[model samples]
Target: MPSVRVVSLVPSLTEAVAVTAPGTLVGATDWCTHPADLDAVRVGGTKNPDVPAIVALAPDLVIANEEENRAPDIAALRAAGVDVLVTEVRGLDQAFRELERVLDACGAERRPGWLVAAEAAWRNLGAPSAGATRHAGRLRAAVPIWRRPWMVLGRDTFAGDLLARLGVDNAYAGHAERYPRVPVEELRAAGLDLVVLPDEPYRFTRDDGPEAFPETLPAALVSGRHLTWYGPSLAEAPEVLGAALRAVYR
Candidate 1:
């Protein structure tokens, strides 16, 4: 087997790959914290990598995600003759496929027992019945990701897919971008059942002043990655999100 040193440029894959193949990781971005030991590397943001620093690392492979990483930087890395594996996962199936690809690239084959276990767990944890029943009465949710311009999760996004899976309809499904900015008044008119403040992308907290919302509306701060990105993390989300939704109903 070829000994390959990998520099991870995307945060999610940085975390995922580190878990799948810790020994192969030579360098990683600041946000890759799952494995803990790789935190010693010089910090690099997900969108912008430290090119010279990466070159200095002289990795055999560079891992990145198509959506999270900028194309020009990937192009630059390729121009420097660095082998790059770019993953684009829009859904659960795509996510599993990308994981498989990463494992294969790192010379790690699938552990059939683990796959079977994960599959069994996923199958056993069915969708929330309460959420489905409450769907009709469910408030169209405005998942504000950013504040200044009021960006939200739009239709055709991973978050939107999760919303659908959770039995709640995304109010911004008609919008264009995956995350778009909308006026506060527009949100009020949309008649939302809940205003979900995610813990990331904007880091909305309970003490962060819910006075911005009308007194009649209910709001809850939720785990952004759990509601949005579905990967290995998703194995934990069905239970977590179901509990959250059940709480909202109760």
Candidate 2:
């Protein structure tokens, strides 16, 4: 087989590829920040990657995510004969399984240690205590990704599934769209016990986001990476998310 040369379009996948097989990544998206010192060509953002620039890198494989990237770009690259590896991860287990697939395609001789550690960390975690949920029933939370038009996590999302594992239920998990846009007033009136905010897609800070929520509902600002990304972050996702969610209990 030809020696693999990779270009990662997704930030999380970039971390995965770089850390698993260092020196193999020749190109990555501008948003890819892990490894901090990653040596690769910048391929623009996830949604608007420079296809011509990517083609010039002569990467044997270009890795992308179904949700983070646009279909037109993936088609354009494939039309140019680039072997595009498009992965879809909707939960923690899928994240690990998909990582292995991507790594194996890139010539991994064995499973990387971080992958093992990440799985163990999630497996060993227990759900939040009953009090943390506060609701005698399952914890109900509104998880927002954007604020301008106001979008919230709805159905079949990695973030939603991750929260469920911690015993925190998503208020809009049954909505048809994976990310549904609802007005702020609607969210507040949705009978939500709390609102979980993540800092990505839009950087929802402690000052900026929590204030938007109605005082009747509580809010917790969590790391966007831990809530969204599916690479090495998976190792501590359970703990990081657990701590943040538990804080809202009291």
Candidate 3:
């Protein structure tokens, strides 16, 4: 069979396909930062990808995510006669399944070792339960994705799901919007046990994020890659993120 050429619009999927089958990617979005030395042609950002430029690459397929990529770009690619594979990952189970499907679509020779390790790591984690840590019971937290208008992980988000599995339940998981803008005052008064701060889409840091919350509220500064991404990073996320949360709990 002929080799498959792929362009990944999602950063996580870019790393996924790149690690699974190197050289298969001829084009990727500017945000596809993993694999550090990826040689794919940059087709702009995920939200505003250059459709004509992508078409010019003539990839056999383009992989995208429902949440990370815009629909019009996918539609435009299809209209340009490109075969685009769009994936949606709302939960851990679905993430694994989608990873397998994506690798298959990319014609990976076999399931990548990292993927196997990631699956085993999460599977062995068992279900989310109250930890025996100092702050007993499942830690309820508010995950802030952005500030200056203050957007947060609301209902049905991949990051929120991952947090839940780590025994950190999102405070806004039942909100109507997947990402809702809430007042900082309201967040402070939300009866949260902790505030989880990730380092992307906002780049929350020691000085930037922690200052927003009351001195009494515990703030767990974690990697946005682990919290928001669903690629090779998933393998070590539990350990990395767990340690961060544990530090706050202690």
Candidate 4:
């Protein structure tokens, strides 16, 4: 069978398809940075893609995520008669299922080793040992994705689910919106044991993010790729994220 030529609008999906079936991708958004030597045509950013450029690629399939992409873009692709596979990944399980579906649509012969390894890694993740931490209890944390206006991970977020699995509970996990713009003052006063910061959507570095929180609160400055992107990074997410979380306590 001729390989399916793919265009990936989502960064995570782009990495997934590219890593699992190299050369299968003909176009990817500018944000698809994984596999750093990716040779696909740059279609533009996730929020504002060059629709005409993507359509012109004539990919056999185009994969996108509901959160990272806009509806009008997906609709425009569909209107142009391009076969678009849209995925919604709210949690770890959904991410795995969506990865498998996206790969199958891309005509991958089987599940990639990375995908299998990612699943196994999460399954075998042991509970967080509080004994090693200065704070000896379950960690109630607030995950801030962006600043300026200060947006946070709220209910039904993929990152929150991963944190939950690692025993770090998101303080805003019960909030109404998946990503909510809460006041910075409120976040600081949210009675959090830790402040989880990732380096994307907004780059939260040691100097940048930690200063905002009270000196009493621990900060876990982590890789946003591992925390947010649901691709091969998932395989190392547990270890990378767990270590970051643990470091704040140690």
lDDT of 4: 0.89
Error of 4 at 148 (Å): 0.7
For each candidate in turn, the TM-score is 0.87, 0.95, 0.96, 0.97
Clashes of 4: 0
- Worst window of 10 by summed lDDT in candidate 3: 126-135
> Candidate 3: where is the Cα deviation over 4 Å?
126-131
Q: Could you tell me which residue pairs clash in candidate 2?
A: none
Candidate 1, residue 51: how far the Cα is off, in Å? 0.7
Error of 1 at 7 (Å): 1.4
What is the lDDT of every predicted structure here?
0.70, 0.87, 0.89, 0.89
Q: Candidate 4 has which clashing residue pairs, if any? A: none
Q: How would you encode candidate 2's per-residue C-alpha lDDT over 115-197 as one tens digit per residue?
A: 89988887887656533457556788899999889999999999998888888889899999999999999987888777999
Instruction: Identify the leading candidate in terms of TM-score.
Output: 4
User: Model 4 misses residue 89 by how many Å?
Assistant: 0.2
User: Would you give me the overall lDDT of model 3?
Assistant: 0.89
Residue range 107-215, candidate 4, lDDT tens digits: 8845789988999999998766532375456788899998998999999999999988988889998999999999989988889888999999799888998999899
* Residue 241 error, candidate 2, Å: 0.9
Instruction: Give candidate 4 misplaced runs (Cα > 4 Å).
Output: 130-132
Ranking by lDDT: 3, 4, 2, 1
Q: Return whichever of 2 and 3 wins on TM-score.
A: 3
